[model samples]
Target: MRFPWVDYVVSGEADLLIGPLCWDILNRGRDIPPADLPFGVFGPAHREAGYPAASTRDLVPRAVIENMGDLPLPDFSDYFAELNASLYADRIHAGLPMEFSRGCWWGERSHCTFCGLNGGSMTYRQKPARQAAEEMIEMSARYGSSRIEAVDNILATDYLKKALPRLTALPEKLAIFFEVKANLKRHEVEKLAAAGVRWIQPGIESLDTRVLKLMRKGTSSAHNVQLLKWCRQNGVRVSWSLLWGFPGESDAWYAEMAPLLPLLHHLQPGPAVRLRYQRYSPYHYTAEKHGLKLRPAVSYRYVYPLSERDLADQVYYFEDSEDDDVGGHFAAGSANRRPGLSAVAKGIDAWLKAWYEPKLSMLSMRDSGDEIIVEDTRAIAVEREHRVRGLAREILLAADEGSPETRLREQLSGTNVMQAEIEAAIADMIARKLIVRLDARLVGLALWHPYTPIPPMTAFPGGYFDRRAAPLGTSRE
Candidate 1:
């Protein structure tokens, strides 16, 4: 009842209303018959059975389409027309937003604690693989845009194995982007890059496995690192964020992980921000269970001069009592702000700055047939090259996607390399910052050589987009 004066608040089923309810309201007066309304179209104002519509939460969602293959391609003629008429016309390389699926497959099984995505019902659905690929290519050609970013929560698993293969053979070079899971194998990453997937957002919130576990992001720090390594090695760019303020996380985890950030200067670094309470997130649905006391976010009090009950019912963002106001919220602020978090935040800032320098930091591990060459230029004066031989090289290669010490030992056992030598090699690599270990998992951080020459795949290439975003005209306004 935020606006009790209004008669109806249409929540969902825009499709159903197109020919019926909309026509009724447009042609006739504001007399919409309840009998003709579709499911999720009407609800009681107070969760009961009556007239005035209820909030989106209290109402049932409209029927979802089983197969989204029949869904028509989005018409961007109006958007482009308006953009062309503006001062910034023809300058903006508009990335066409496409979709292959609805709801996250991972979320259907295990939802991320802080993410309120896919609504309450996390039912995974996707179009036929061949159909999806055809639609993407059609859209790209139709819109005259090479970059097509998928709007799906998490990319459909089938799309990678089936759909992406089709794109690899396409005549035009498409720069596609998708939101993927972090536990991507080396081969999977290779497939993505080969299929012209130029960018990805893997949703890597924290590097520490403990912190990751706390967020229910079934991924380890090593897994995250390997993804970065492979992405950098290929021409693919990675977009991720560092989030803190989970219930059971420790500052100690960041302390262990922060000092090692300099070792990863060659890789991309995401902004570190604290978690915010979203409407349907686990933290919001079960606040007391997670030891969080939520209030209707401090700013909402000023925005809407309503009672606590009304405020709670209205606002989507809620803040925990334990949270600090200075660097709170999901902005590009707050480098975690705590003890170890301070170091991590600073490291990320440093990493971001390093990318813009005249001579960028280089840390690449190239594997020749017989030996491996590891060159380190991350340190100012410690520009050195090390030739890896025998078991050490094998260990590094084996730890491509990051592996447990025991698993690596077992995998290399047939090589007749002693356990002592393997341990020493791993420890030495860790000490030298060639590979990092978090909770016994080791992920080697280094770049690989791509087939073609491309600019360094650094995160947020300072002023690159800004320069590109400049108007394509002589007049400067």
Candidate 2:
């Protein structure tokens, strides 16, 4: 029951507290020892130029809490307020940002060949669905904004099912964003569309099945394609996370993946596809346990030699051919370029600013001036969208009523939505936090029921009853 962070906030022992602000406020002014409060700084400068008060050396202790500096510092209240104000300003100019969870779940199972998280040793368990929704609501309130980007490694399927009802009950204006595993089931997709989930980013690490298997991904390329198709059918917008440069991966694998370009085109395109290079980091415990060969941490001075294939592959994506050189591994065109280091640095800076200091972009539908147009040319289109939304709402509402049959029926009925239209609607709803789809079940439902008073919407917002009511007297024969 006793929360240490709350104690620190209450006892006037902390100046700046990060992580979940609600927990800090809830336990404020408790009797506890003053502790070091961790803060996440933004700006390309912070990551590139580095913080003057702290270096990478000082980062670990501040983050760990126990190792906080004992020296007197600035007034806690003013410092925190300024920091928050700065973050708020950033959001206003950048984009609404939200972090659902951190670290990878699979870290506990098998360390991916190219993991960077303390060799994948430090894994953080996911917050419960209810707790996550509460935090999301609080964050939305703080920003006076409904849009959120969930910067989680992967949004777990069960969490989606459990949290859907609570999320659906939130004020019907908040929109949520998050990423998830690609192999979600059909019913889960329907549930998500109903709940009001808006933006979905799936980690499609590779298109090569062999490469996927080597990465220990528990999904197949076929599953990835299917998930994309489902998103298109149900209305989910996808921002794909791709990885390149896995060891032993051949040019043939890249060639095999080339065919997937058209598939990417079929999915809704927002930001240009983010392609990342695989950086190998050996975690002490995890690598040893997995029988992975541990590489000694290299100093900044050491440079690895790249083969002809590496050079050729790197050039394929590099926009400027002129940048290719022997020392070009850390070249300007490399996707791995650090923030504030090159032209790509601008993109990173923009991302951090948009993420931390939320900015509304055209890509975000809430900021659009035009009313959303629903063109139901086909009989199935209208019926499918309405049915899916209705069933999703039933399942969501059933959570409160505690009717198992209603929940099951709601799920079974919703899955009947036409594949293409359902995918499109689900994509749109997922981006808005109206619903969340995971593994073919209505895992989590946001409170965007079609009924009036929006029924005390809970999780996030952006629910509207403007949708054309119930397929206008049955479809034309």
Candidate 3:
């Protein structure tokens, strides 16, 4: 029995049984058998009769890289570049996700008590600005990926300033997205906007100063507000992170910060102001330094240490306090409470679809696919439908199709099938590798001569050829 790589084990396939090895068992020096693997080690476990055995021991190694010296940083950039090249090599791949840097800038100074970085130690590095920009350009050329998502913990303002010139030189058609500290200067915001940076995720953990201090966040509430205002003024979309409970927080603090909701609404409403609660996790150094202790973790609905004003505010806002004591509530309503793993995943999915994918596809169209008109139209349709559906299905479907054409077609067909029942009949034909383009030529008129093919249907034995020949139907055309 071989152990599966971490990715394969967590990928959620039934036949994909993952087991531990003798080395792993010996490393932990435990008498426990590898067969006793814990269910829900990666995530949730079903409470059914038969649960798969998973190791209860910690299997992952925790190490922080301060400096590689002679050893070079693994060129994950090249790996990702190749990955995107393969993905977008045909039908203009929109919303391609990329990260220019990793971890947080504050990691160099004071680690956020909640973050897990540098193997739970604080760390930071400045990726070469030119290298990062060139990578984006290469990705665009190779995969026609116009949208770039820089999944850094927080892209330091100074780094952005240095990277701005390089980013400004990128194709105007390309859109960039990244996270930043909420204390960006006015000039920094302007420079980012000028550089085609469209989406900004700011860590505005809380409006309460005490909470910010507790989290070891250096930025002030005033600074967060100023940055948001500046970003909004420059037409930059701000996606902010709001955290709620810290150890010393009480009902009064929550009430005091409640007014920040309207301010956030005024700054950037709807999905733009993403609020999330982060339960404090005490790592070795921070725990020892602050003498912090972990509260017994509870389920999503567990409400502990309740208060009257907190309950009243919950009722007044028509929001149900999450059963667990995690903080941050979206301004839209308390009904949007997300206190569990599933909700966090859904939120991330929504963000990628809405802000990241289309732009990436637009940038990477050249390397991924032929410049055929049919494929172009198909890509455009897929992108448009993705915007309407909020990009959730596209991200999910992208996980399935390996070929560029298949992925693009699957996305379009899946989106169309969701929007209209009429498209259901043709969806299977589009999914199976049977048909590739639709013939839309009349006797002499060839307005639709180069129509992309739809998948073949078993219901129509003649390979669904006649169905494609019928009078042109109403399309997104």
Best by lDDT: 1
Candidate 1 clashes: the total is: 0
Taking the tens digit of each residue's C-alpha lDDT, what string does model 1 give over 130-235? 9988888888788777778787888788888899889998876677888898888878988988888878889888888889988889988877877777777776
What's the TM-score of every candidate structure? Answer: 0.87, 0.44, 0.45
TM-score of 3: 0.45
Candidate closer to the true structure by lDDT (higher is better), 1 or 2: 1
Q: 281-396, model 3: which lDDT tens digit per residue?
A: 23322444543432333332256344443332222111113334233333334433423322433443353453333332210111112221211222223332111122322322
Model 2 superposed RMSD (Cα): 16.5
At residue 37, give the lDDT of candidate 2.
26
lDDT, each prediction: 0.73, 0.43, 0.43
CA lDDT, candidate 2, residue 298: 26
Error of 2 at 467 (Å): 30
Candidate 2: C-alpha lDDT: 0.43
